[model samples]
Target chain A: MITLDHCHKYFHKGSVNEVYALNDICLQIREGDFITVIGSNGAGKSTLLNCIAGSFFPDSGTITINNHDVTKWPEYKRARFIARVFQDPLLGTCPSATIEQNLALAIKRGKRRGLGKGVKNSERDIFREKLGHLHLGLEERLLDRVGLLSGGQRQALTMLMATMIKPEVLLLDEHIAALDPKTANQILGLTSDIVGEQHLTTMMITHNMKHAIAFGNRLIMLHQGRIILDVDGTEKSKLTVDDLLQRFYTVQGEELSMDSMLLT
Target chain B: MTLYAALGAVEQGLVYGIMVIGVYLTFRILDFPDLTVDGSLPLGAAISAVAITGGINPYLSLVLAMGGGFCAGVATAVLNTKFKILHLLASILTMIALYSINIRIMGGPNIALLGTPTVFDAVSVLGVPPYLAGVVVFALFAILVAVIIIWFLSTELGQAILATGDNPQMITSLGVNTHTIIILGVGLSNALVALSGALVAQNQGAADVGMGIGTIIAGLASVIIGETVFGTASIARAFFAALLGSILYRLAIALALGVEFGHFSFNPSDLNLITALLVVSALIMPNIKKRLMQR
Candidate 1:
């Protein structure tokens, strides 16, 4: 349940190298909607997510999360209602911390943290139960440093961490792009299971077009800081990459470039 | 080593090793280069000495001395966290301020703490031998501090402080207020240093305003030697390594004073030189070790 109206974002505003990151964009997300975002580099896929995550303030827009204005909130303050998993696995976790400590921090995401004896036996049990579902054996290695983990395991752990308290919205900024294909697929499967289990409203940005088509009920193609096509339900199910290419041509009125779009 | 030499060196090492623990907390644990130790060490000594001369119990005076160092740390933390001063600048400001503050606290250049009811006085209160006081005091406090620190590092806030050093951004995203953690870590670290300073002043029977001139370097030397000797992969081993390193460093210095009488005078001035040489040796120890390993 999030909405953005007439959002505008500029980089280095009033300077020579000024660029428009988001321009007059409008988007709405329903509760439990899994939206896939696909675009070329500099297409504002990340800026859009950044805008939603309170990383950047829109120059002109009203953002409402579950009907409360959050446009002016700071990143730390917005973190109360939102959880994000970065593209890099390392970005989502403290490498030197044990799995249980990191999970404990995530569990108390919006609260004051202090020197309490951390992760009681019951909390450890809960984290292990959640980690067990990932099937990566992180649950068994709860005392191990997260730095020792493989990228895939870390990503899965981050996913588990992000939804530990089930924030109002989940932002996945190409959460699996850096992993090898098999690990990426595994993380994606974990993502689906997590989203389904938590009923989280999610926006996932990906460079891979097949994942864009296959993962979500709703798909939006962003080109030049604007949504070019918004398809969903059966229309999205029937759509192939070829059909998506033709639609991008019709919508943006430009031949599809960026080889990544066709190769995948 | 002779009995006198071993006892003297080990006692001094144990006292200064507490300073090393303080340095480890900020430089290694909190990742803050708090220069406040340069002033806080002498500040603790001065405060404890003055308090002891003022008819206060030496054990209580030592605690007050630690509190003085904690204040210095808190002031630095506040400047950096609340006033937005850069870390190095904040510590410089506090270190500079403490110089004036210590002069005012002692009301003079120095004070003596002998026969002043120090923590070691209790052993003699029970009619223990005079030579055993330093050993008794050192063992009790060093062991106590080590256990507390190990327990604290296992805590939630302590882990967050560790995480803050590794990546503040990740912790902040998880809603950790890193500034608070830094303040707590620095306060705790310098408190340990000041406690060491208090004991050193009492053991030496006097506190001079300049006793802390190379305190940070000495602490760094101990920590570096510890890490090089025992490795830094695990937390518990690192603490034990630091303890062993401090003892080793003191023994080496004692040996140098004993055998190198022709090369250099074993005076107070030589301490700075010795510390500088120890640091250089420590810096080169790792590379030398790696080269030796390759063979």
Candidate 2:
């Protein structure tokens, strides 16, 4: 579980170009809660996730993961409870390293690393078994450099790496946005399977409304550093995109103007 | 070249090979363009020479020299990671500061080890010919260093260092303090470089304040040449490549200095020029071969 209370993050404070990225934010994520987050550019969806991820501390307020206060924890220090997959495929995996080596890194996530052999002979079978689950034939290329893999394959591998060691929280930030539609669908399907199998507490940011609505148990819409909509369970399942747009109009008192969000 | 000259070149190669491997660890593995070696190498020499002249055991002096280099490297890493100095600038700062430190350590600009006992003395007692003593000892140490490096790179900590260089963000998300990894990596790299410097000072029987001048350039040349010639398809192969590259680089320098063309000869002053040319050719050779193959 994760909790954020009255958090605020401002960029370029006191400067003419100042902007509030996260403002007066409070959130609580329950164990095994898969929450899908939706927002347009500059809506603070990423800022909210980043605050929880400890990329930077909030200007005000506290964050707790499973009851331990982590407001001031650095990103690496908090990584014990969190795993993240970036939008750019290259950002998630070490390209020059072999597939097994990358997986080996994941296996020791949030754990002390010593001078022992990184990839044991016995671990090869485990890695192969896990890679086989991706259905990408990566197991056969265990020794191959990750850079040689396509963007889709790499993203899929990243997702597997993130969940293999079982983090308390998993953050997916537009992870499949850059892939082809066919690959995007494949990754999305994989995401669903993995989340369901592990019952992972996940927060996935997506530009696609259909995905945001279709995947998670809960959905929250962010608008200008505020949570404008939160829907879950039956209400979320019964609601349509039109309902979401009308709700946005009613809540913000204006028509939704983000064309990319509308188009997606 | 004559056999003695060739042997001398090989001896120099083995001694400097340790420095080349250190360069590979930082520039290639850690992705830190550390200029600290320029100072740390001489720092090691200064410490070893001073300690040796003060009646300390030669082998223990090498350890002291490595420890000195480690501190210098840690200083550079801290300046970069903690103080937020640019990595290149931080290393340069350490290097410049070491110029003063090395002199203070030796209490002079140079220390002569002409009659003092050295590590090679122990090897000489093993019945090796006097001329071959340096070569045998240096070869044994070089191979030992290469083996240790190869083993270290396969370890869990080594993998973390590789990941830190490859993708700091990814490694951080995996729960690694990249700052700590960098500090350890850079420290180890400079330690080996200092070890090389100490051995070189003993082999040639003198430690000069300026001995570390052009150290980084030569180490980099050896690394690039090793990668180019040996192909870094694997970590073990890369280490061996670096060692052999150092040897090849020294041999090339010796050959250049020995040859004459139409009454023209390369002066010893042309060492840096020769190193630059060697690195350039090694770097471009791969691309040229690729193009030729395409044709």
Candidate 3:
């Protein structure tokens, strides 16, 4: 569980070009809440996630992760309870490292690494089993460099890696946005399967409206550094993209403008 | 070349092989083009020579030299990471500062260890011929260092170091403080370079402030030669290749100096040119092979 109280993040404070990336905000994310977030460019979706992940500290207010204040924690320190898969395939996994080596790194997530063998023979079976689940034939190619894998395979590996240690929170930053439709669908299926099996507290930022509506138990829409809509369970299930658009108009008292919101 | 000359080259090669391994750690493993070795090598030599002149045990002087080099590396890492200085610039700054530091450490520009009992002299008491003593001592230490480095690189912390170099963001997300990893990795690299410098000072019986001027080039030449020739499919292979590469590089230099080529023999001053040519060929060898294969 995570909570943000009156969090504010400003870029270039007091300067002429000042911009508020996150405004006064309060959010309470419950355990096992698979939250799908939808927003347009500069809507603070990423800024919100960055705040929770400790990439940027809020100018005001506190971030509590399971009752521990983590506002001052560095990115690496907050990683003890958070795992992230970046939108860029290259950002999530080490390309030059072997598949097994990447998995080995993931297996020790949030833990102190000592002077012991990285890829133990005993752990290889677990890695193999996990890789086998991806159906990417990466199990047999553990020694092969990860750079040689396809983009979709790499993303899948990254997802598996992010959840390997079962972090307190999993953040997916438009992870499937870069893939082709077919590969995107496959990864989406895999993401759902993994999240369902683990019941992970996940926050996914997506540009695709269909996925934003289809995947998670709850959906929250962000607009101009603030949450505009929050719907869940049966209310979330019965809603359509048209309903989302009407709600956007009703909430903001203006017509929806972002084509990305409707096209996806 | 004569057998004695070949053995002598091997002796020098084995000693510099340790420095080549250090170079490999920064250049290949960390993807850091650290210029601090130019300073750290002399720093080690200066410390060892100074310590030896002060009546310290020759072997113990090497340890002190390594400590000095580690500090130099940490300074470079700190400048780069904490101060936000570019890595290359920070290393260059360290390298420049070390010039004065080395002179200060030795109390002058140079220190000679004439008549002092060195590691080679200690090995000579084992009944080995004086001509073979230098190579034997260097080989024993080189192998030990190689084994330790290989073992260290296989560890979890070592893997994190590798990941830090490979993907800093991913490693940071995995809860690794990449700043610490960079500090440790670069520190270890320079320490090894300093150790080699210390050994070289003992072997040649003197440490000159200018002794480390082209040390980085030579180390890079050896590593590129090693990786180009022997391949780096595995960590152990890569480490051994670096050592082998250093020996071969020394032998190549020896061969170059010895070859008359119809009155065009290479002199000592042409050593830089020779190193440059070797590195150029090594850099292009894969491409040449690939082009030939297409035919």
- For model 1, residues B1-295, the per-residue Cα lDDT tens digits are 6889888898888888888888888988788988899889988899889988998888889889989889889999989989999988999888888888887888877877666677777788888787878977887788778778877887777777777888777777776767778888898888988998888898898888778877777788888888887877777777767867787788878876776456655865587688788888888988898999999
* Candidate 2 vs 3: which has more TM-score: 2
| lDDT, candidate 3, B64-120, per-residue tens | 999999999999999999999999999999999999999998889999999987878
Model 3 clash pairs? none
Q: Candidate 1: where are CA atoms >4 Å away?
A: A3-9, A24-26, A56-73, A221-264, B82-84, B261-267
List TM-scores for all candidates, in order: 0.88, 0.97, 0.94
Model 1 backbone overlap count: 0
lDDT score, candidate 1, position A223: 82
lDDT of 1 at A226: 87
Top candidate (TM-score): 2
Total backbone collisions for each predicted model: 0, 0, 0
The positional error of residue A37 in candidate 1, measured at the CA in angstroms, is 2.3
Distance from true location, Cα of A86 in model 3, Å: 1.4
Which residue segments of model 3 deviate by more than 4 Å?
A12-17, A247-264, B261-263
How far off is residue B276 in model 2, in Å?
A: 1.6
List TM-scores of chain B, every candidate: 0.93, 0.98, 0.98
Compare the candidates by DockQ and give the number of the best one: 2
lDDT of 2 at B172: 97
Q: Model 2: how far is B74 from its true place, Å?
A: 0.5
- By DockQ rank, best first, the candidates go 2, 3, 1
